[model samples]
Target: MSRGNRWARSLILLVILPHLCIEIYCSKPDPFAAKKKRMSEKVRQMFYHGYDNYMMHAFPHDELKPLTKTFTNSLSELGNLKLEHLSEKYNGSALTLIESLSSLAILGNHTEFEKGVLWLSENLTFDVDARVNLFECNIRVLGGLVSAHILATDSTNRLTKGTYKSQLLNLATELGERFLPAFNTPTGLPYAWINLKYGVMENETTETSTSGCGSLILEMGALSRLTGDPRFEFAALRALRKLWSMRSSLNLLGTILDVETGEWIEYSSGIGAGVDSFYEYVLKAHLLFGREEMWRMFQLAYIAVQKYFRYGTWYHDSDMRTGRATYWQLTSLQAFWPGLQVLVGDVTAANSSHREFYHVWQKFGLLPERYLLDHQMVHPTERYYPLRPELSESTFYLYQATKDPWYLEVGEAIVDSLNLHTRVEGGFASVRDVTTMELEDHQHSFFLSETCKYLFLLYDDSFLVNKNYVFTTEGHPLPILHSWHERLPEAYIPSNWTSIKGEEPKRASAMSMQICPASMHNCIHGNVQLESVCHIPDARDDHRCLSDEDCGVDSTSCRRRLCSMAGYCGQWRYH
Candidate 1:
């Protein structure tokens, strides 16, 4: 061959080699894709394993006694802290099946979801003599039914296409009507426990938790929207307003209250069992219904909580009137607060609390029911781990927000922990004692409804791809359709807070195309920068600051502002 031909061939090789290397780099399979698929399947199997066992051993009952390999008629016993109201004649209304309906849909088991819906529509009744907790029933049964009905009717799912009716909605409406009698008191606060068959039970306890009264709006409002009946939403809204009005001057709420007198029964409150869902529902109701009033309420309440309840990464109970610290402890349910913070674009604060919660989960095999922060020990009696989904739920939300692979690792660790310590032959059981890792007799319905569902979504979130959904506190998904509400209002800063006018709110949502905090800017959705609506620029001039707090967060980037050496707020350096 000629020397010129050899030189030309060498030049061609150089160009081809560089292109080949670029292709190789770009074409490499996503490391997480296969692992995510595997985890997704693992979650699917875990869900079905528990679900199949519930079908076999606890069909029609409220929950599975995994340890006993039997059933417990537990609907009436739920929230019965004293176990005082077990009804002998009350038959199971297929509580586990109701709870499992939306899970089945999430797992892509449309056939089973359809079958479950049909069976429930035909057989279930709220007429039994069982006295049930209003909160539990609304969230689990009514929320589940409404969610499943929406899924059934949604064309995307292609579920129950030809045979579909509004059966679930009908049942939900019936349950909502039964709930109405509980709201008949002069104060508009519903009783905590009400007999489904008899209406508010004679001489029923007048006392209820803040959450018990305040968290009813989302489910009931959805019911009113779906059925076009105003009573359910009206009752719930009135109760929420009345409860907000009852807040102490510090804008703090007590743990427990009297339904009839509209008075605080337990003046100390924290972001735990008694009051946690109240905060959750208010914000979520705003997202779900696009109600400006709800957003305003949530903004004030959220700020108040941050000012009083927060202590670095840990939150302690405080007196409602004085905002003085009361109880220095951590409950498993408090884990959900971080997820809420993330939704509001407070990613920095959310990450801080999330790490602490994950540390506790790592310390124990799973999250214990209560950990006393001051003593750095598990609460003496409340040491059980109830297969609660709060940690996993938060992890999923954080992953959606940041798309950080580390959050996926956190989820993987959670899945492994649950399988290792909680999975029983019959189903996943709760830990009777986290210290001993002793299995409890029962698996709560929320395990299927929320725990497995959130874990599965962490891996494969295709279900959320094009949909706008706000998950009910029970983890049931409700679609956010602009057509359903009168108008979807954008969040705005109160006139007192800002002098800026007509600025659009910035984009700030995890994955769903939903409403975000008023101040959130340039939300990143699927790696695409979508412009935010009603954006609020930082009011400070030149980003100058003396303290870290003065260096407020960046509105568009959702990044924390750092104090530069020159004493001005600037973007934090990754290093």
Candidate 2:
């Protein structure tokens, strides 16, 4: 009885044990997957809500006045902060519709995207007698049109033959031709404002932001590539090259410049609104046009920005000539720095900066336009929170680069914040002031183009599969074509993202890898293994050492410094 009973019990126990193990391993449905799907749908609905409302009330206007269920011809009014010189006869260029074109394609609404494309091609014109900010017009209207054109004619897209005759390209070319006059200054740098119908307006302001003249290369260059007319690209490149030549010895450019004189006007500058895209564009221009010159410019400029403006992951305005900190403040636009950094493989610094921006966002339920870091309070006058997409844009890039669940969580927080505070029956409204959560009537076109697009991409990036893109400052995506690139940057290669670490990293260098200067900005957060090789000192105090014995470990990142190169200590190589 003992032998038979024992044999039966042992067999039964083995069978049950294996079944129990399988159950335990597969018990929980993946939380991240669920959240990703749920957040993706939420974002999709958010897009349609705003999109439908804009169509309903503001279809042919520049922007929706959501609070009034009306529209604003905000194009000429965009950078005209004083609302000066707005034409009484001005009509909208279907600004919101153009902005939504590429976004609709990204969201996989080809039918609706096609509809908007046809409408624009047939109806919209830049011929209105309106004075517009050259920079804003280029990034928003020109960027939007060029991007949507590419998407419209993409091999993967649907635009039945003959139905599309490169009409958008024609419109873009006409608009681009108009932009050429602004570049006819004594200096190649374009005027800050131009009249669409008559060209550069009489006595138009000679002053322009560095970004105004510097950021046109992408859209204009792409227009050249598509049109086979070098005028557009040549004009943009002339301006950019001229602007670069104007950089201070520190590789810095000021916030404002005089196009006619080729002289800097306002020398205090930061990587915020006035000068932000100048940095973003150079690197992306290299990627898109395969220009080695752009790559070199971007590399030197980035190092200078890191060395001077960056303080423990935060960047402040500095005298371009002196490299002395000028304005110790954070503008919401600075949130784009992390995302820009991600494109060039500066993830560690990017992560650290992104977290700081998110912390501020959490504090206000939105990022105010300006926060004076010295006083630790919002700027008294610049207290509004426009529906900016920078934080979400960076969040998307970080998630793509790292596959971290945390970025998805950040996107979730952003989506929830928009829904809770900004959503209105008309559309999403801007925060007039973060302190009171008071709302404004205007709905920015980027609220649809960048903010919603990035959050949606963060949660669902199927469109990015098998393709690489560099987003314009306004959040319009232009594919990084193989022909456009020389030898592709390793960063542009599609990663096998089944694992978090992705493909084996390229040969490490201070700029190519994340070995940040240890003086500030955590070199690698949550990277216990990385800590061993991440030391880069704030200063060089020692002479050449031929052996590893000369150098020691770093305290902050738990690094091991070594001696190898320079007839000096290169001991523990961080990269």
Best by TM-score, which number?
1
The runs of at least 3 residues in candidate 1 whose Cα sits more than 4 Å from the true structure, single-residue gaps closed, are 1-29, 162-164, 487-575
Pairs in steric clash, model 1: 504-533, 504-534, 504-535, 505-533, 505-534, 505-535, 507-532
RMSD of 1: 10.2
> Which stretches in model 2 have alpha-carbon errors above 4 Å?
1-31, 159-162, 486-575
Clashes of each: 7, 9
Looking at model 2, residue 442 earns an lDDT score of 90
The sequence of per-residue lDDT tens digits that candidate 1 reaches over residues 308-372 is 77665578898999888899999999999877875665554566678889999999879999999
User: What TM-score does candidate 2 reach?
Assistant: 0.82
lDDT (10s digit) by residue, model 2, range 424-525: 999899999999999999999999999999999888877776566778999898887766654223443236322223435433333333333322233443
lDDT of each: 0.78, 0.77
